[model samples]
Target: MAEQDTVRVGAFTVGMAEAEGWVRRYFDESRNREVAATGGRTRPYAYPVYDRFAAGGAESELSDGDLLAPSLLNASLGIRAVYNLQTLRPRLEKGLAAIPPTLTLTDAAARGTLASLLTDLFGVLDGPDPAVGLGLTTLSKILHRKRPLMIPLYDRRVKRCYCGDSGDHPVEPVSRSAPDGPFYAAVAAGIARDLAEQPVQWRYLASVAPADVSLLRVFDVVAWERGGTRDA
Candidate 1:
């Protein structure tokens, strides 16, 4: 009998076949789709925006141009629709400026700093303006650009895959007053361990993923593709 090819993802053990299948599916849908399944000009892929952001230099401090990074990736169309750029600018500038440009999820020494940055970013969504559209998903997208090696994208699907939160009872938007640091810190730690423990698996996944994508991003694609339907 053949040994099962698997890797640990947070609390779940995922088969390599399943993970790779999702990665391929994601790329096809994002990169190769000529039309939406529903039929329209296929929405733009986020990678172009990512490339543009990188071209400008992925600095620790937020720049006017860098704001474009988070808005393009997800289904939301754009972050600006929800967040007033002027309202978000100051907080984003201060919060992101504190994060080290070189930080990665695997760095144990920088765990506290990572958590602190997440906590501060989450505040943008929870701040005084109830109309502001920012959420955990957008905050994560922004951080992923700034620290792609360290931050994983955390959309509804990724949340479903990792947290086991299903569509029926969707995860609630986090309150401003909630302590955000510990949860994201734990999430980052689990991903760190997953990447650290499975070198062979990571290498295979990386080799198959789109060039220039970060390890964290490759995992995010795999996890989001899994959704809540499959534990693997």
Candidate 2:
């Protein structure tokens, strides 16, 4: 969003080195330990429905006359959110049946071939909104549903890191609230960039580390980049 916004340079506590070592460590370890869940059956995502997340499933193909169409909303989350082979196959099958059996993939392998396929087809996968679904809740149970793993999930981290205990981290203007971030994205990028440019600890920057995979370390980056106090 604000790529060139005047970065509150000296205010950041965690420097480039800290982010590099921390983030990489956290990501690597999480990836190593946590087996990615198999789509819809996964924990918190289903929590959305339990929380009454009403976003419709992508249209069913073997249903009533006239396909419901492979919605952009369904496509968006299906493509990005469902990363496991077990779940991806079903989504791909549904996508193909409703849209074009040839739309995503016809045959999927169980050992994560679907995730691999989607990764390759990302270019085609990138398209209009399949749907727009948002249910905002900071209720402790809703917010702390799952421990954060590698790759920051954005919002909650933003609230915890930038906003502090209050829950409004690096409060980006409401208008800039997409995943790309007018605020959060910029801050994360800034910190990552600085970490990338660091001269010392070249290997740490080059490779993902074990510690930086979870929020335990992610908060440091979010806090530092979101304009949190350096002294903290």
Candidate 3:
């Protein structure tokens, strides 16, 4: 199929050409990290964390590295100073146990399951204190790492892509202060529909993207790169 083919994903109609462009950009960025590592910079946190978690199997509990991954990815080193791993481990583990390791957000039932999980997990992760407290961006990042096929990353750019109103004026970005479980489910459902309807295209995208990145992440990069600027 030509890259220009468009598919409905979430609230937006995404073009394959555009999606491929953005996903390719994301791959290039991932490659750039390798270059950075050659310059003596520390190894990347994303793939390493993912590989470690996958290697340990679903029966394993979240480790200190799991907590630190999103923290470092978000550039919040201070989280380590106050976040009590012992205090949060049980809750985090409980939440993870409820969601199957191989779950994918690809249907109504799956979307509902994702919503319920996000509702419960978000409550556990978002707090007034900075330690356990994380905004949507960080929270989504953590969940995306844990369930790559199910959760889409929801940073500011992604919010702009899905939450904006159609008008001449710019829409205000959605608040990251709290998690919106329904919104996430909606996004998941849309992506599921796209993938279900466009299997060949999704397979093509998967083939082109980094092996470690999930289909969810592929769509995320597409939306993210296509998403409007914060001020736009």
Candidate 4:
């Protein structure tokens, strides 16, 4: 069997053991409090907007205000970007329409579909620096809320953590130079495998979200905690 620490999905490899350790540490009382302190505060409008979508809300129900709410919230959390809702409205509507409410993480097809969808959305932005255009983190948050179970958040910390890069040498967005379909699929598969193989770890996450916590969300917490500090 392969080592639990090293997970290889296609050409991409992740330090699962390090991520697991962070998850474990994050559950500790003192550590949990410390990490929670650094976490993003809830934006009142954001939750309702997300809840509406999660409850099978139609794409037509989404407005420019709905899309911009999360982006503004992201800016508050220190993920910076300038989004023109008026310009991007049509594209955002198309992208949201592409998302099936029944999407599942366990479905192999979902990853490729999501990656293509993200690429389309990311391509809609007009900016000099692709990195700063739509903002990878902001996009991830939007996707996560849209499909909480299927999409994991991909901020600077999570990207750096997964790529094993230093803050001084941040990695590029997965969609910048190439289609990130395979890469996103690999990550989704890896996280699903980890959760399946480790029931104890999955159970540990119940302390974070008792009733319903997606494995993608668990990975998000681990990545945020680990990446914000240092490489494990």
After superposition on all CA atoms, what RMSD does each candidate show versus the true structure?
5.0, 14.8, 4.9, 7.2
Compared with the true structure, the alpha-carbon lDDT of candidate 4 equals 0.50
Off by over 4 Å in 3: 1-4, 7-9, 28-30, 37-60, 75-77, 80-86, 107-111, 126-133, 167-183, 228-232
Candidate 2 lowest-lDDT run of ten: 64-73
Candidate 2, 78-112: lDDT as tens digits: 32333332223444344333322222111232232
Better of 2 and 3 by TM-score: 3
lDDT of 1 by residue, 1-232 (tens): 2333986565555678888876665555455434443566556344445534553644666655565566567435255643475466677677766666666776742354555656665556553554355566666776677777767778666655445343332223342135444455545555676677787887788788778677888888766665555543
lDDT of 1 at 151: 71
Give one digit per residue, the lDDT tens place, for model 4 in 1-232. Answer: 3654554221233565665565455334454445445777721222223333343435434444455445433533222343454455566667656666566555533345644654555455434534344555565665566566666667666555444333332233443344343444344454555555555545555345423445566666665655566434
TM-scores of the models, in the given order?
0.71, 0.27, 0.70, 0.56
All candidates in order of lDDT, best leading = 1, 3, 4, 2
lDDT of 3 by residue, 189-226 (tens): 54566677777777777788777777877776666655
Q: What is the C-alpha local distance difference test score of each model?
A: 0.61, 0.31, 0.59, 0.50
Clashing pairs in 1: none
Ranking by TM-score: 1, 3, 4, 2
The candidate maximizing TM-score is 1
What candidate 2 gets wrong by more than 4 Å, as runs, is 1-130, 134-153, 158-185, 197-202, 205-232
